[model samples]
Target: EKWAATRAKYPPTTLALQHFDAAYGIQLGHLWPSVRAALLCERKYGALVNNFSDDDVLSDLQDQGCRDFISDTDLEVHLEQISAVGVEGESSDLSTKTSDISHQQLSPLQISRNIKCLVFPRGDITRFKPAKPDKFGLLGYYLMDAASVLPCLALDVQEGHNVLDLCAAPGGKTLTLLQTQCLGFLCVNDSSISRTLRLKRVLHSYTPKPFLSGDNLRITSFDGTKWGEIERDTFDRVLVDVPCTTDRHSLVEDDNNIFSRSRTGERRRLPQLQLELLLAGIEATHPGGEILYSTCTLSQTQNQSVVEQAIHLAQENHSIHLQVVDLKPLTHMFRKTFHFAPNLHLGEMVIPHLAANFGPIYMCKLKRLT
Candidate 1:
């Protein structure tokens, strides 16, 4: 009852409507009657619009010739704005047209099976039940979505391009990069040896190849902070998915008992480590290559602040520059809490409310321009 009252009292404002119209070159008053009606109702009647059913309000607008609603362009712009506002990440103007890499030589059954496992899988009923399910993955486990994984997978990883996955164990993002089948030689390192072995087990589930079967893929047990000892500019693409406070997960479960003090510590410790890992990843990345830094937390300190710090470090020591990628179209729900630094551009933080399946995850794609 308390939750319901809180919700009812603080409904989301529709500020995006104005921004949407402005972005798409649509006249707010004339585009859709329903939208216009809602606007006028909110302006004149104020509290009355809250009582009206969404269907009724929309139907009334439709009847009034508000047919030309915002287009996909507007939707994309609105989504970008929200994500930009929520997290300090910049959205790229990169085209969505992906290249066809599907191999025709593989049998149809094999292809179908691979696609099924890659895209969708039906498991036993028992798999659906969690043994120790928290909103976020516990300890070395992390549940991530395509928004965080896709950009890493799409990078052009040519032959002989060294790659690194710092803090990679129970590796989902690491697996995505491997699936691209482009790394010259891959290094999958994690601080936990047991988790690294678990990652090996997960990799075994996929089809075996020279990369998987041979020593081409190196699995190391080491701290990510020490990864800077590796030769500078050695990797083509480096992934830094750091550990964070997991505050967003707090909303889904009653973990007050276990997380109370630890959560506070995480808020402080995560930003420091995040910035360190990014510096290590940037140093490890080949000049003109890309580094993707991600975290499964929502704090601006861990997300925006770390990226800004890395950019500053790069400017001071190396000639590296950071380019931001926009992530608005994919994350539509949480636009309110996004924050950014005035000087630094690129990277984003996903808020808890925006994610449908996972807790908040922040991602930043940066190209090393030296």
Candidate 2:
């Protein structure tokens, strides 16, 4: 009612409508009609489109005498309020101790450190689709969270390293590992048969022929919990991108959406399953090797608590030695664009941004001591 009343104060223009349509095209899932009507009633509707694409469209609007177009600079400044952009380390929450990586080994992956490249993954990812689809996906790069890509960097993959991506379906992180460093062999596994097929397709679509034909890649559908008993101490580096409550998929404006039905069930089963996967990754990693545990949720029960419980269980039950790899230094480097959530003793979090619209990822890097 308040928004509607405020919107009534202004009038909509044709250029504004066009720009709103473009934004709706980009975020097709979030087309709330009420919001659209409100945006139309007010002049505030069209500027959201400016954030997703370059200024060429705006230039065209200007040429058409659409003087009402929002400038990119203005959008960026507004976006900062609801975004993680420009946050400094000193201002971070003191409750969560930052992961300390100073004594840890440096990242083996060569990073571009370019803000442009880092921010590209956060944009309307469909823009990354290629004109021609090839095995290499030369133009169709897998779009994923930039923070999710950080786990591979945390692993510090070296040439000839043996790696495992447990629960590796839809192959985004798997692709990152392959792209970042040379590996002797990579074992990709997911428990679901259908998801495994999707992972295989992703691998086949992106990996080159030499890698596919070579004995270096193994794709499997196995119960991930049994991996610790099955492939204990096998991999030089391991990644556990465990399944969790993906909040993005759960968000719906309609009260009657079926998506909420399994929310309780998922929350109930997720933490233990997450711990099982993390422990399995730990068991599979060679002594002195590292494992990167990550999830796409903001739930503390699933993120920090799972890592803490797994660490305790591994020590008490299996008598295995594990160490949380400090990520403080790395987080410091990324503070400007991606400040982590506070009070995390086990990992780093990238909170979801309403404007930027990417991620709610949590990642913890761990090493097997013995």
lDDT of 1: 0.49
lDDT of 2 by residue, 1-370 (tens): 6556543232223333443355434433343343344222311111111111222333443443323211112434333422332232233321222223342433342331111122322222222222234333432244455556666667777778998999898887777777643678989899999999997786666556567554988888999988988989889889899988564433422232223443446556878999998998889998988888988766667888898888888888888788776665555445444536655655887654433344557888877888
Model 2, which residues run further than 4 Å from truth? 1-100, 103-105, 109-131, 134-140, 252-259
Q: All candidates' TM-scores?
A: 0.56, 0.67
Please tell me which predicted candidate would have the highest lDDT against the true structure.
2
